[model samples]
Target chain A: MIPVDIPLWADLLASLLMITGGALTLIGSLGLLRLPDLFARIHGPTLNNSLGLGSVLLASILIASIQADRLVFQEVLITLFVVATAPVTAMLLMRAGMYRRRADGGKKKAPQPDEST
Target chain B: MTTLLPFAVSFALIAFALAMIFAGIRLLRGPAAEDRVLALDTLYVNSMITALTLGIQFGDRLYFDIALLIALFGFVGSAAMAKFLLRGEVIEP
Candidate 1:
């Protein structure tokens, strides 16, 4: 990797942002795997959607701006997209999981709910 | 600044990669369908962060586009899958 002429403050700030972002991403994924239930495990990645991605994006913004020597706003597009979409995706997935579980956990004694499209 | 910054970036890259691997393991081993989908969602977001870290590491702006694409597609795919799981088919009257 070629070293660029980034100033001290930019480098320090980027480092801090990256380290925190990476750790939060790891913790979120860990929770996704380790949590006992689907609902609980589903929450593990929200950390990524919120702070994890936020920190990383901030780092990218800082470095990119410094390198380009101007205000670059491309990265903010991703931040906005993630903010708008992550919760909706998670909610729909949770509802699906709950629906499936309810229909399945009926012990097979009761008539199964029709799943025909 | 010189010594610590690069080291920190490298460490962050490795950590994000490790996070992706963890999400992959969960995606493969998750018992429930929705759990797998959730893991898959985590996997893509983790990968996106990895892409962003690459931008920070190598000092390139192109990686930003790549990361953005991943985020867009990952969200669409996951949401569609979740909808399918909910209703058997993604589109209905």
Candidate 2:
């Protein structure tokens, strides 16, 4: 067994980061359950993608590097991908919901006529 | 260090999995298509986090790659679902 030792400070920080991130994710999930509408639910996952994932990735990078005595930058790539993709997906979902509501004749305020429309 | 890490990671992962299950239930129970879509989105995010936790547990770099791929594919699937909902069609051609 290769004896791997991480400094106490590093361990404490990493654990704190991971636990906080996990808690945030749990809260976001609870939001999904508690929110009353589709739009409201969308906000929950957005929080996870932005802050929850960000914190977790940071913790992973920090912990791995300290334990292995080498820098691990791969987590950065994942973080970048998640952040870039989340907003586009959310926007698409919102637009889709709006379109479907309109089609179903649900009670929604009418969009003002625009040259594009 | 080893013991503490394994316990922490496992606890966190379990919590996250429970959350995902709740979100899944919401998806199934949604009265509206858009509500289901939002629930599905939450499911994807939770699964991604679970994958990350697994990577930490096994100390393997490849798991990170898998998580990234999942994120990519998840984004595409979500986009397609949204598009289908929006236009009543997925493709124009």
Stretches off by above 4 angstroms in model 1 are A1-4, A103-117, B1-3
The number of the candidate with the highest DockQ is 1
Ten-residue stretch with the least lDDT total in model 1 chain B: B1-10
lDDT per residue (tens digit) for residues A4-108 in model 2? 476667666766767877888888888888887776678887778988888778877876676577898889888888878889888888877665554433465
The best candidate by lDDT is: 1
Q: Evaluate all candidate structures by whole-model CA lDDT and list the values in order.
A: 0.83, 0.77
DockQ of each: 0.74, 0.56
Q: For residues B1-93, write the lDDT of model 2, one tens digit per residue.
A: 453555567667877888898789889998788778778878888898888877777777677888888898888888888888878777889
Best by TM-score: 1
- For candidate 1, what is the DockQ-based docking class? medium
Cα lDDT of model 1 overall?
Answer: 0.83
* Each candidate's interface RMSD: 1.4, 2.4
